[model samples]
Target chain A: MLKFDEGKVLKNMEGALKLRPQINEVIDDVFSRGFSNVCWLGIGGTYASAMQAVVHMKERTELETFYENAAVFLTTGNKRVTKDTFVVISSVTGSTEEVVQAVKKCKEIGAKVLGFIDKADTELASLVDYLISYPLNEQLKFFMVGDRFMYLAGEFAEYDEFYSEMDQHFAKGIVEVEKAADEFGKEFAKKHHEDAIHYFVGAGNQWGATYSYAMCYWEEQHWIKTKSIEAHEFFHGMFEIVERDTPVTIYVTEDTQRALSERVARFIPQICGNYTIIDAKDYDVPGISEKFRGTLSPFILHAVNNRIDVHVEQINRHPMEIRRYYRQLDY
Target chain B: MLKFDEGKVLKNMEGALKLRPQINEVIDDVFSRGFSNVCWLGIGGTYASAMQAVVHMKERTELETFYENAAVFLTTGNKRVTKDTFVVISSVTGSTEEVVQAVKKCKEIGAKVLGFIDKADTELASLVDYLISYPLNEQLKFFMVGDRFMYLAGEFAEYDEFYSEMDQHFAKGIVEVEKAADEFGKEFAKKHHEDAIHYFVGAGNQWGATYSYAMCYWEEQHWIKTKSIEAHEFFHGMFEIVERDTPVTIYVTEDTQRALSERVARFIPQICGNYTIIDAKDYDVPGISEKFRGTLSPFILHAVNNRIDVHVEQINRHPMEIRRYYRQLDY
Candidate 1:
């Protein structure tokens, strides 16, 4: 529980849960108005977070969903993004230049823009056709947006039930994650602190969480060298880099592609002695249905890993919020 | 040129060029049959190679094009892929298991499957509705496939002219690449040989080449750790890892998104002293049109970097073909 604020975490989760009705209203309004496809646009962590939702929608529904980089989308216009497209833009700061420009482009194309902003009076909130403002927490931001996408993709009733369950036992999930952190954080950090490179592998929806942790948290915040490889692609070429003590974290989620992670699990110990498997199935979430466990694994895994972030910060003596170049100098 | 095979290179180039007309025929035939959308499917390096083609098609035409991971697609089906979808499958050996499975799935869904196979008789070649057999050079494979995609996406006459030009001076481009490799390969290897991690930054079409070289060649072949960060995304988070002596390579291509690369070009030298700029514009590719330069940069860049592979092989004493786990293990 070092450097942890339990009250803040609870408040943030509650605030995110409060946005459920507003998000549902936006989804309903957009569908009723008629849209050709859906685009989830953001930069950096925001883009990474939306990707989990994209994978969920792609698997469960026939809705056309695109997870695009805000800046890259500007330079290379997508042919599928038309006047009738519905765009969901996430920006906690509400001033990310790339997301703002993307919102402008979407507006110019006559697409409906929904903004998930942390501040109500910000530029992004003003620009979007519909806005949902909540407390700024990366995990909560993704969960809310992902929930909305799954709902709009025709899993509304199922997701509503799941969300209701989460509402009742949200505090328990947090407490369980914190307990895991207290048990594993120090050991994980001690084992990996001096490692020059870390390979983060995950399959299915957990791939986004794995990527976000590697790029947004480790590489961006701690300036550590990390490569986020999907479990399926890990065998193709990346496995060659493995050594006896190569630092590897395998995130196992409950999904159709869990076998993919299991394959890596079986193979890694054969080559890498420093590998650690963080299986979401290890966690006990009260009131969550078995059907919804796979869908909610990313959120749970992210919370568990957030503890590792705190421990890593303490062990490495590198403040998690410090960045060497991001927003420090003009590029 | 150290380890250069001029005759074999010319032969390979000729063989790849020979497939152009056949590839075009397939494209024409597929369009004539009337398809709803395009699905470019592959895994690892193959998937990375198809990404540039997907980006080109997305930008130039109104066609809905998807660049999907073969194994991931098998587990989580794409909503856009339907009976009317024209799925393009690339497998050099004609027997990548994931791709074969994906082809089967596409066929099951009644989609027309096109296979780009290296051999005439293989499981994947047999399974696909149409097959184009050719020598498997990564650059050539992508170029041919990308050209086919562009043609199908409504750039027939322009791409046709570009192909004609490439066919004439194809040898010249290879020769120019060999010369650059001869000049710069040893130096690049010497500077980067001791580095533990490499940051490969590229934008536009060059992003695919950068990712391929990083994942397939460096990590797979040499067992050297590398992070392939898109130029636009570099500013977002990846730049935080930069140090004064961090090894970095910026791939600059002549495309609409050249500015994105240029942004990194300007920033990298300021933050990292051991940085190299491999600009495609630096090479003199005789007889290739200015309009066609961006389209062909991947090929030129791949050839130039092949020398780096040779030098890295020599300095690190790691045979490019040696794999610790890939294909050797049953994962």
Candidate 2:
């Protein structure tokens, strides 16, 4: 049976980059398309990647983009699909029931499908007009998720060479990734604060990663609330939720999306006056890949996330129970 | 200046009755074609009504049923609309941007179009081959918003005269609605327990309403964690979150859909022992139409939601704030 794991998937990202030479082609397709709209589609990992990609794309180009809420498919819809739409459809093997269904609809509707598949002779390959394939060898199952992300990030950052450089930089770090995590854990254990709620704020692609890794799964696992939001979006309405007690953590990086996130971070000191700001540019580690490093950056962002949980656990003196309420809603 | 409120709705519910006279026709139309599937599309108030109606239909019929989550267009969706697909396009005026787009696409796909309309010769009416018209007075907004819910519910419950009974029930309850809310507030205040987080759960149509007004908005407004899940789908996972301290309020009714919810409620005691359960069936409010009453049976639910805010404000609790660190993701 195929199973997906968070920690393991994040750690082994190297295998996601055999197609690095084609990075320029994809990036060119993105730039060639300009500030036009895009449709990011996938189930599970692909969905998560699309969120990050769309957010990041918007951050760089200031172009309008939309996310297809996955829940919508099961609820109510039969809207027409358009071929003009740039759909980045990602699947490890390029085959999934929902993804395949979506792909077929897109093809029929004339939407340009940019297929990201891992396996050979996949249906998605024949379906999409443009294709990018990543092999994802076994050891990197732990890392390929990040690897896939870094490849995309490198394209977006417009640094094919810079992206190439990052693969090596990240791999060296992965060798000692555990020691780094342990050391960070030790430091976090001692610096625990009471009643700290983390706000993982970013405007672009990182916003997507922070949301999935930080907000959804992490909070569920640890019972600690982490709100990951687009920084500018935060300013419009959510900033008011800020107060003295709430300690916000901003995940910063040098990627283009940083401008908005940084601006929001700058205002935090003035508004609520206290927040932990980690400049992601200064701290980068990966065995995954460069494109994905930014996407998977939040995994490394556990310095604050872990400590907050450990500290809260130390204080609540209770084990964390991830609560997911799925009660019946009948007539 | 346009604002949509459920209470402001006329609740005349005449459209439902007017449509009832043609119930056999609609039902015949529904079955004769034996269409592959059905699609319902609407926006805002009309959208909510469509949701309620679809859920009601599912509970009343044995035919395979589901809702497509039309994110951009309530009516247009990913499911391929074909000759056999019956498109149920709902628009108060049939002029909403996305609705129009979807209807046009439905025709493009050759699906039979059915419209729930307010005006004769209106855009949606002209677009769909089959037209079901409501009294299109300016006052129909009320029917569009909620009163129709009563009509649909009454029809589902086999109460043919329920709408007129509703006119009487509401006329009576109108005199006491405010007092009821006030009474509800006081009762909530008296037994208000601050020991744990308030968990309000619902599934299906009520679940949609509760999702919009209660969980998403309420949780964000008060910084209290509230989640809603689909009933039957919840059994797959997420049942483990229930605990003794966390009260699970079950909104119950005698409506046909109650079978699933009631079954789930019956199992709750075994799963989470010693939890406070709110079963609206436990209360008595006179003159309320059976289906309407079954629904508003959760009237006290409004006050229960309010009490959560009261407690949150009393605690001065809020989420943290942060500025972005890096904004390097693509736009």
Stretch of 10 with least lDDT, candidate 2 chain B: B322-331
- For model 1, residues B1-331, the per-residue Cα lDDT tens digits are 6788788888887787887777777778887888888888888988887787776555576777778998888887786889999888777787788888889999899999878788888877889888887776655655576667667666556876877888898766876677776669888887887668898999888887788889999989988888898898888777888888888999988876788898999888778898999888888788988887777667778877888888989999988888887778777
After TM-score superposition, the amount by which residue B197's alpha carbon in candidate 2 deviates from its true location, in angstroms, is 4.4
- Candidate 2 — which residues are off by over 4 angstroms? A1-11, A20-38, A42-47, A60-65, A78-163, A166-170, A173-182, A189-202, A223-248, A255-275, A284-331, B1-242, B247-331
Task: Score chain A of each prediction against the true chain A by TM-score and list the results.
Answer: 0.94, 0.59
Candidate 2 per-residue lDDT over residues A1-331, each given as its tens digit = 0122335533445545444546446545654564234556654444555666544433333233444433333232223234455566666666565577767777776667666677748886878777766654222222232233434544235445445555665445543443344445444434433333455675444555565544334344444434455554454234545666565767775555566667767777765655767665555464445555554454445333444455445555555543444223221
- Candidate 1 lDDT over A131-163, as tens digits, reads 877766555555565567657666556776777
Report every candidate's CA lDDT. Answer: 0.80, 0.48
How does model 2 score by TM-score? 0.47
Top-lDDT candidate index: 1
